[model samples]
Target: MVYIAEENRYSDMPYRRCGNSGLKLPAISLGLWQNFGANKPLQDSRDMLLRAFDLGITHFDLANNYGPPAGSAEETFGSVYRSDLSPYRDELLISTKAGYYMFPGPYGEWGSRKYLLSSLDRSLNRMGLDYVDIFYHHRPDPDTPLEETMGALDQAVRSGKALYAGLSNYGPEDTLRAYDILKSLGTPMVIHQPSYSMINRWIENGLHDVLREQGVGSIAFCPLGRGQLTGKYIDKIEAESKSGNSSMKPEAIEPARIAAFRKLEDIAKRRGQSLAQLALAWTLREGGVTSALIGASRVSQIEENVKCLEQGPLSEEELREIDSVSAVIKDIPW
Candidate 1:
């Protein structure tokens, strides 16, 4: 069956500028991490992509090690792209990253120029892409020289393999250093992907201020605290709950965490937003954040989360209340 995107999709959502760059991403982008892996049904993944595009999600994020078996998510995305999204290629913002355990051997992972470029080439092949909109050095490498990694990013842009370069999961000090190197190379780092949510707020420590001042945009992933803020486990984990394989397992949701969650739920109700919606809205409140990178296995989850657009930059009172719950929710077990 042929999939046709909605012509009015552009009006379904809003776009915000990514840093000072010319690129603008949807307020909520889709991430191909867990549910899009080979372990899941291809048709379900395809349907999610189509519905996301129809709802104006222009950016789709991927990483080389996203699947149970690394690289399978990209392979799945490639299959769907060839069958459906190829026609709307010009309207999409596709990004893929390296610097994680992608394959075997020493060269399989890390920030070395050899690994980053080769991994990107393989990524392009897997996705059948001429070039990704932005290519990223997925994380900071302690052993690899920052210059070598940044140079590979610059080389990628100079070679026309990627339009812009980015960094993910990097801390404030490292981001500053990398930005200086990339700027000197004349290929500025435009964005950062960070783990952020109501419960997990490390970016608030300093990264948010740095990104805002440096004109680098941030896309926050896992804004729901892996279902803690979703009201899913507020009462009890459901029979069909994904808690078994979830990063936030049942045992990790201790009584202390639930007490804090209950408070947040009450606050969200007063704000006229669900716990999940409030979590998403809170991440977007900061001017430095470009988008909320959300993952969903089903279409209904996407539909429900998109309503975050209708929510808010929570009030000062609500914000204070949320801060009170922060301590109880941090350092969740992996």
Candidate 2:
């Protein structure tokens, strides 16, 4: 059957500009970090992509090392693109990153121009794309000169392999420095992807201030704290079921954290939201990131998560209660 996207897809969802650039992304974006890998069923991944598009999620984020064996997630995304999404390509915001360990040897990983550019070409080939909407440095490289790394990003944009450049997991100092370097190269940095959630409030300390000063938009990943903020482990930590979630180690799931999550659940109930929705809402509240990047195992999870947009902003009282709970279990490394 031919896949015709929902005509009214743009009716309900809101879009925010990426930093000062004209690129506007959906308030909620889909991330292919986990379930889109080769280990998952192709049909299942296709269903989630189609469902998310139907719900007005325009952005799909990926990275070189996302899949179990590395680079397989882009292959999975490419398969779906060639089949169902090719016709609607103009409406999609596709992004992919490189950094971290990809292949062996010196040029395999990190921020070197050789690795970043080569990895990007491989990524484009895997995704079957001429150019990505945004290409990001997955992480900073301490050994590589900042100019060389940022120059690689500028080169990617100049070579027309990526429309805009972005940074992920960079600190405030590095972000500003990279922004300046990209600016000097005539490619202004547009967005930053960071791990932000009720549990991980590290961005609030200084990164937010830097981004605001530079007019760089932000997309927050792990807004659910890798399923902790979802209220699934409020009663008991199921080690077998949650082992895949990186933040759910036995040592991290202390009883005090469980109590804090239960308290958050209570707040969610009062606000007429599920624990997941409340957590996402909190991540997008005042002074929060421009977009919340979410991962899903099922189409229903995407359906439920987008409802966070329908809910009102967190009230002053709700914010205070959330703050008090967050103060206890701050920065759980999600």
Candidate 3:
């Protein structure tokens, strides 16, 4: 069948500006961090990508080391893009990052200029893109001078290999420093990707305030807490087969946390939403990230998650109740 997108795909989903930049990403973006690798069927990856676009998810986030084999997710996305999304290139906001362990040896990872630029080239090559919309330093390199790393990102935008610069997994202090460096280099830092969810509120401590002050937009990953907040664990706790490599560990699913998840599920029911939807809605509430990045194993999961926007933002009372329930839940020591 031909893959013509739905005409009304842009009708319902809202697009939020990325920091103070001219770019605006769909409030709900799809992430290729998992399930889009060579290990998964290419057809499944294609289906989810097309369906997410059909639902107005214009932004697809990726990284150089996303796949199990490393670089396979970008290949999968490249295949799908060439086959179905080629014509809509101008309408998409594709972003990829570096800074994690990718290949072996000295230049394989970290925020060094050599690794960052080289990794960006590989990412662009794997995705079959001439340039990415946003290029991010996946994490702060403790050894690499901040100037050298930020310089590479600035150079990426200057050379037309990336339209904007971004940072991920950087703490509040480092983010401010990176922002200053990018700004001085004449390229405005646009967005920051951080891990945030109802269960993990680390960003609330200071990251949000820094982002607001610096005018950088934020997109939160793991807003579902690695699927723990999906409510499926309420009835039964299954061990995460992937363990450290991928999914959350079974130990994180303690009995008390499951009970708390049940309380959240009850709240979701009262709000006329599924647990996943409630988690996403809460992640995107006022003063939250600019977009909530979601991963989907099935097309139906994407559909269900996108509907999180339809029920609207969580109310003050709902927020309080959610906070109370999740307050006791601690972040897994990964």
Candidate 4:
């Protein structure tokens, strides 16, 4: 089947400057962290990718360990890339990461120069791309020297395997170290992917200041707090609800979390928007966030999230009220 993109798609989203970089990214970017794996139907995944493109989401984030059977998500994305999005390659900003378990033994994961370089080659081969727009370390490896990790990232860009380098799940101190190493290597880090939300305030502890100082952009993953901040579980976890499954882990649905979700739901009611919309808008309240990396299990969820950008930024009073409520119940097993 032939697919044509919407002409006015770009007008729907407001792009934010990525720190001091020359690039502008959509306020909300789609991530294949969940539901885009081989476990799901191929057509459904393809439709989601095409629909996101039509809505002006040009950046798609993936990782080697995203799928249920590791690497399946990239393979699925590769299929769609070749069959549908290949013609629009220049218009997309594709990114993938390594530094997680994929194969067995020492060479399978982490920040070793051999592992990173080999993983990039495997990722590129799977995606059928000569080079990705951005490559990232999935997470920090305390066992590996920071210099060695940064060196591999530097080489990835130098060898033309990736255009830009980024770090994910690294704290402020580690991020600063990475920035300095990448700077000395003459390939300054461009982006940092971290878990942030109305409930998850770890970044606020210090990471934001460091990123701002270093001019490194940030894209927050799980901005909705893994569907908790969405207020979907206000009453109870429905038997058929996706959140009830083992994949979500029952421990994540603690009593404290439920109470906090209910309070957020009340705020959403006052704002005249769904709890999910409120949660997404809250993430964009802080200006430095270049994008909210979201995962959706259904097309309806994506459609709901897209409406958030239309509501614009939150008011100061609204933010204050949110802060007040957050202070009362901040720690929610995110």
What TM value does model 2 have? 0.94
RMSD of each: 3.3, 3.1, 3.5, 3.2
lDDT scores for all predictions? Answer: 0.87, 0.90, 0.90, 0.85
- Per-residue CA lDDT of model 4 for 1-334, tens digit only, reads 7888889889888888888887777888999987988899989999899989888899999988888678889999999999999999988999999988999998999889999999999989888999999999988998999999999999999999999999999999999999999999999899999998887788988999999988989999988877667654554443323454534346445555555567778877787788888888888877637899889887778888888877757888878888777665544443
How high a TM-score does candidate 3 get?
A: 0.94
Tens-digit lDDT track for model 1 on 1-334? Answer: 7788898999869899998999999999999999998999999999999999999999999998887578999999999999999999999999999998988899999899999999999999999999999999998999999999999999999999999999999999999999999999999999999998877788989888888889998898888777667777675533323355544566565666667778888888887888888888888885537899999989999988898888657777877778888667754534
lDDT of model number 3: 0.90
For model 4, the run of ten residues with the poorest summed lDDT: 238-247
Output the TM-score of candidate 1: 0.93
- Check candidate 4 and list the clashing pairs: none
Candidate 2 Cα outliers beyond 4 Å, as residue runs: 238-254, 330-334
Candidate 1 vs candidate 3: the lDDT winner is 3
Residue 253 accuracy (lDDT) in model 1: 59
